[model samples]
Target: MVAGAPYPHELLPQLVEIFSEMSVCIGYNTSLDLGFLDRIGVPTEHLTVIDVMQRFVDYLNANGGTHRRASLSTCTKYFDYKWEGTAHNSLADAKATLYCYNMMKVIK
Candidate 1:
């Protein structure tokens, strides 16, 4: 969580509003995150979700790398991204996911 950020449940209305304006949501394990958002009353029905983990695995398979599953850490390491923050921190993890996605796009 960021400094002075509201808790998920407390920010439901703002989250819904923000998500509604977005064309798509991209994240690692996006289904899980969307599910949690849905459970917390955030509306995500209109959003298309792009999961970086799935994209990474598909990229690997298509490029002759034999990876069955791709975690955030694995993808970041494969792309040689250095981690500067604690693992599992949401903001850091999100940054890593975006970096991995951009790398995949470059490779494609």
Candidate 2:
């Protein structure tokens, strides 16, 4: 997350408060994430959501000609991202997802 984006690893704390003030966000499965926020009564109409997981899927299907959903571990490992912590864990997954987004941008 940047200066204005919510840091979700805070256990998704203060969701309504945080998202209500944010204009953009980077997330893994943003539909589910945003859905949760919507269910919790957080209005997300104004958010520019960047779903790393979904973007990875679009990238793969566009370049590799495959239709499938890739996991964070798969995307991270494909880019040979060195983990700063345990995989599958929340914070680690967040970092890995962002890393995937970074690599995908530069590599083709």
Candidate 3:
């Protein structure tokens, strides 16, 4: 996880460089995360972001599942994924997001 305060001057350049090289960034609530990054002075205009939460909800609703609002925990539970570590931890959340994405992809 990114420790320290947001938009540390020492980290901005490196973040910009890394983001420039990335084709797409994936997150649970990507728009919110991107807004945070933008507010923190990270250049996100060139980055394409995928919101796994939205996709997961859409998938569930389109299928037989009745999920009006799907949380990370709900999605993981529905997919039968055993979550390790604490909830709300960025690393664990990322892993869970990936798992949800993979499972949804298989359905598609």
Candidate 4:
């Protein structure tokens, strides 16, 4: 794990390699999740992707919710918070994902 805000690539590959062995990959609504990993040279072909956004979006649709936005900024506004640090940095992104998941639960 990284100790500070920005994560170095050297510290990340091992963790990704381990998790990539799994048959399934899951993330909220972010295609950027796997996309980012792929850009960094991780093989994503072995993994089956599932977007949790669909599940949550379906929930909202069923409940007649009119909010059509799910981007990070919109999500932050609706949920009443934003992530604490660097945007594109992987470690910060990970924390944002956790915070976003919690926020989604609250708003939904």
Name the best candidate (by TM-score). 1
Residues 2-105 of candidate 3 have per-residue lDDT tens digits of 57667467687887788779888888878788887787688888877788888988887888877757789988998998877777988889888999899888
Whose lDDT is greatest here? 1
The full ranking of all candidates by lDDT, starting with the best, is 1, 3, 2, 4
Candidate lDDT values, in order? 0.87, 0.79, 0.83, 0.64
**Model with the higher TM-score, candidate 1 or 3:** 1
Write model 4 residue lDDT over 1-108, tens digit each, in one string.
446646647757785767677887666565766778777777787887766565456656778876554554454455565667876566665666566666666666
- 59, model 2: CA deviation in Å? 1.5
- Could you give me the TM-score of model 1 versus the true structure? 0.84
- State the RMSD for candidate 4: 5.6
Model 2 residue 19 lDDT score: 76
Candidate 3: give the clashing pairs.
Answer: none
My TM-score estimates for the predictions, one after another, are 0.84, 0.77, 0.82, 0.50
Model 4 ranges with Cα > 4 A deviation: 1-16, 21-28, 35-52, 65-69, 105-108
Candidate 3 C-alpha RMSD relative to the actual structure: 2.7
Instruction: Estimate, for each residue in 1-108, the C-alpha lDDT of model 2 and write its tens digit.
Output: 269765554534576677779998887878886887776577788999888888888988888658567778878877899998998677888888888888877976
Candidate 4 achieves a global lDDT of 0.64
How do the residues 1-108 of candidate 1 rate in per-residue lDDT, one tens digit apiece? 479977888888888889889988999988888999889988888888888998998888988988877788888999999876866997789788888889988988
